[model samples]
Target: MPRAPRTRRSKYRALSSLALLALAAGAVTACSDNDSASDHSASSSAPSSASPGTGKVAKAKLHMVDNGGHRLAFYVTRGSASTIVLDSGGGEYSSQWKDIAPKLHTATGATVITYDRAGLGKSDVVPGPWKVESAVSDLKAGLGQLGVTKDVTLVSHSQAGEIANCLAKDNPEMLSGAVLVDANLPQFFTDEEIPRLVAATQPEVDAAKKDPEKPENRQLISTAEGFAAAHKAFHEVTWPNSVPATVLVSEKTPFAGSPEDAQRWRDAAASFAQEAPNRTLVTAKGTSHEVPTERPDVVLKAIEDMFAAQH
Candidate 1:
């Protein structure tokens, strides 16, 4: 496979600078380490679970999965047709994908599944080591309990990117394709990357240690947790050798880097697509980190593109 349509070296240089600047701003201002900032992370309990609307909704049901007694909450959207699974971002529960799943179902006529992890949303939080293998297995079991088979396409965002990777790696045949939105992919996290992120978050950790629920502490954990959750294994999910997919990155929130940071998410995705049956990385122009909620149209189109290629 040819290297083909990659961004020019100059572009990478520019984006790289941008990345640095962003990181500097984040560092000085304490991007991920800010305890003062509020990052809305949903609680991992049934009492705090989001409700499914009764009026205009297409009648979805709440399904529970028993991962060796660890219960996870999931919404099953029964559209007039097909099946699609929506995966949320870091520190996010399935509740977050509520808006996007319905739109996808209405527009594309597919059943969509969105759920909370073991500790987020309605899922029961556990005290075990949350690794990548564990996360993938939970996802697979949830899908299995719902009877979602190999004919499904996964729509994953942010930290769930790792989960998507795990699924493709574990059960390649169970997926038709995937929709990756602003996910931290391309190797999960290298050794250098994780420590740097953790070190960068020291201020937040320090703040949080003083008060677990303190606002300052919450912000830092929110930042660090997003990065950490991606690598937390659920059920042996790994990246697949060939996944038909689209990667949607934010244009509003610049990749947390300097002016030199090459915002070549498209270039990277194009490179990844080399092995994918079909792939595209598009810009969600003027969108936030909350892409699925902020720009369902962008996600819908991307998924449509993936299915189009699959067909």
Candidate 2:
């Protein structure tokens, strides 16, 4: 396919940067030595013979797999229970879970996996917009490459929650459960609302672009156009009622907006939970949209709650 014109590409890049910045600040940063961060997994737990689904966290191995031409980096903390796969928010790297994953592993005693999607962290970037379907495919391909094909629990934050939803819908049998943290629910967004949503998040994008040296400027995991595309795609997704899920609603909103805006955020989260047959909503009283970072405890508890509900 022909690439978009340079002028269009620039516009998409600008919007994508804004969308990402608004939804998740500090997501785009210069790539670092993957070993420096993933090394934390080695200290998390030791390898054990516990069988899958036994809730035993063993030492995890770091993996850097080639997803087609792009790299997908992840840390697999081995355990005996259903593996918990952590999916970060839009443009956020797996390191967003750094403060949470180790503690979560220790607490749940289940294998935990956190990874950088196609273009984040140390992974390679792809062409054009980031599609929701493509993101789901990458997760499956990345997991399959690691020899993980079943008994998986998906824990996703923010925008990635949309990807997790599609994963559960398409492969209900593969998932043990799902945990959504302040996830985006396109079902709740109307055509009129999208532009408003985009507009609301534009300031952050503008701020990032205003300063070209900002690391986030280079973080090209998902463009605003990609996010908008995913939002539309999510509307067509049908999450299986058979998949146990836990949706966490942060008390704070993404931007410092009116109380009504915050309420709408909460409502959207609540609506997502209501749609699930086997799901519950847990409101984190003192955190913002950066649930995984600001309130790892809540994220951990929500995952634990989902596991308990399923088992």
Candidate 3:
């Protein structure tokens, strides 16, 4: 095939670099584990409840919940018995799970929830550097106000993994299980690996700095501000042993272009699964870093299995 034009190639390269930067460095926000703010009152426009066996797809109700001063938007498809919360990757909106959330509700008869992070999608953006502690507090407060305080199956992708790890560690009783899809595991943020990731993504961070007014660039800059130190703290985070989890690692990991980094990614997933008896690792065969989009069947099956195990 003929090589693309210079502009096209540059655009593609920039996008690819941004994706990689978001994958590795976006979760590296710092705050004390106890830095989470208290839950704020959530105001819902509609009731988030639907009777199972109504012979119709459950309608998703939009709920805007306050997290300190700004609000996070959460969409809930009501069902009885269990709740499944789908968190998107960094630089991504909750709409990433639009096709899967309703299917999960239909297949498992569980209340399905999806939300935009602080700056993504319709959620109000809080100025300053991003903090995983604040992200955890947003989800916790949203669930609490929605009356989904227990029996939750948290399904997280990419950078959301950091939030999930902290949430599970701090509020173990609230979660019954988790399905992590091609997520950022703590094992990959070791002393040896963090510097390599930072070095690789620094160029994109520099590019983002030039056009910081763009939303994507702003997100990249904010998330990468404390990349090195934050990940050092992230490296110390551990998934709670009590919460059962199924980790889905894509066959073509986020670092597919780099064989060395790809191996480290795979090794991290395997190491995590090996550490806890309750943890399970499943490879999403013939898939890319976008596992949820590339292989929805694998993602759905893993989630359904985790949901079943919770009962």
- By TM-score, the best candidate is 3
Among all windows of ten consecutive residues in candidate 3, which has the lowest summed lDDT? 16-25
lDDT of 2 by residue, 1-311 (tens): 12335643444334332333222123231111111111111123322333345554355566777655566777787665567898887656776777667666776667788888766676667654555656776788777776678888888877676677667777788898888887765554545455666776566456545664433443432345444434444455567888888888778756435575567667777877788568888888887666676677778788887766666
Q: Which candidate is the best by lDDT?
A: 3
Q: Show pairs that collide, candidate 3.
A: none
**What is the C-alpha local distance difference test score of candidate 3?**
0.77
- Flag regions of model 3 displaced more than 4 Å: 1-52
As a TM-score, model 2 comes out at: 0.76
- How do these models rank on TM-score, best leading? 3, 2, 1
The root-mean-square deviation over C-alpha atoms between each candidate and the true structure, in angstroms, is: 11.8, 9.4, 4.9
Residues 1-311, candidate 3, lDDT per residue (tens digit)?
12335643343344333232222234444333432334444434432233457776457877777767778888888787589999987777787787788778878888899998987788988776667887887888788778888999999988888888888888899899999888887888878887787777778778878888767767777777666777787777788899999999989887778898789899999998999999999999988777877788899999999998888
Worst 10 residues of 2 by lDDT: 30-39
Clashes of each: 46, 12, 0
Candidate 1 per-residue C-alpha lDDT over 121-193 given as tens digits, one digit per residue, 9 for 90 to 100? 6677654333444567677777766667676788887666756765676577888888888765653243434
Compared with the true structure, all predictions reach lDDT values of 0.55, 0.63, 0.77
